[model samples]
Target: MKQYKLDFNSPIGIIEIVGSDTEVYSIMFSEHDQIVNVPQKDTPQVIIDCQQQLHEYFIGKRHEFTFSYTFEGTSFQKEVWTALTSVAYGETATYKKIAASIGNEQAVRAVGSANGKNHLSIVIPCHRIIGSNGTLTGYAGGMWRKEWLLQHEKWNSKGIKK
Candidate 1:
């Protein structure tokens, strides 16, 4: 695995990407900010590609990212995150939608809990999930940052399937 940091604004302060040869393993905000365990290791190919794609995303030139990645989570949590990635940029999905998508319509609270526990941030796009009431709610990055991100996607992002 290869790990590197890129400075980014909002939720995750400095972003860290853990990569393999083919795709990113994880993209997390440097919030808890655990330092890279080994800086001497070669930069992983996945990390390199992910950063390039992310640059395009921040610049509003990209929408969907194609990468082979795996996340470790409960089967239920994994389901939630998986559905989150399907949510197009600038679009928001309610917790209710996430629960239903995963075939557990009554699991809204569980879905919300899992969303909070998501170690991967933007790559998983957990920030794109909101309350069924159509309000921003329960973002691990802080709701204010969530609002900023959604608004940024809504306003700045182009070349997307709108």
Candidate 2:
């Protein structure tokens, strides 16, 4: 399988997206030259496409991501990830809501775990999920970044609460 990489400067931070056969396999935050399995082909088509979409997202021109992705995890985890993808850009949902959305209302804890394991981050909009009390809760990318992301989107969106 061919591999590819692209970097995006987002409001939160720089994100690196790695693709294989046009399907995104990993998306992680990067600060410096990290050990990323770079693309063998310079400016691969997939990488370019990813970078363009990311740029649109950061500028608030896009709300949804359209790309094939392979998220490796348990069935339950996959369910959580699938649910997370439905979270619209610049919107927020609760862990309990996400848990309930997956038809496992009693699995909030498991939902949190699976959410923490979300690799696709913003594309999957994992930061859009919050706590049951409307508080900024768990986020793998740090709560400060989460608040910044949400506030950024909120500011641009005119606080529609979407």
Candidate 3:
């Protein structure tokens, strides 16, 4: 498969969007030195759309993403990721909740593991999962970024911009 990459400057940090012409593969936070800005003309349309949607999200101008993406993971992980998408835009779920949603309530830890492996980041909304006690938990992008996302969604839910 032909893969394309692009780096986007977001409020939280630099993000790397990777995809093919027809489908997004992953979106991840890039280290300061890892980002390379690809000119718009050279980027695939899907990646450009992902970048634009991300920009809208950061600015609170968009709440939902409309793009095709392909998941590369175990079946169980894909199941967990699909469930993650069902989590409301401005709402949250616990790992336990996600496990239960997948009909494996006892697999909370496994659910967390699958979530940790998610590559789609904001598009998958893994940041929407919190601890059962309503406390924030692990986020690949750092807890501070997770907090920022949760707070951003919270503010957006209330029709207020932060």
lDDT of each: 0.74, 0.79, 0.90
The candidate maximizing TM-score is: 3
What's the distance in Å from true for residue 39, model 1? 8.4
- How does model 1 score by TM-score? 0.81
User: Model 3, stretches more than 4 Å misplaced?
Assistant: 33-35, 160-162
lDDT of 1 at 148: 78
Give lDDT tens digits, candidate 2, residues 100-135.
Answer: 998889999999999999888778788898999999
lDDT per residue as tens, model 1, 1-162: 434443333333556776556656677666645444333356555666667777777777677786667888898888888888989888999999989999999999999999998877777899999887788887776777788778878986654542
| Better candidate number, 1 or 3, judged by TM-score | 3
Please give, for residues 1-162, the per-residue lDDT of candidate 3 as tens digits.
778888989888999888888999889999966558674676777888898999999988888889889889999999999999999878999999999999999999999999999999999999999999999999999999999999998888788443
RMSD of 3: 2.1
- Give the candidates in order of lDDT, highest first: 3, 2, 1
Give the TM-score ranking, best first. 3, 2, 1
TM-score of 3: 0.94
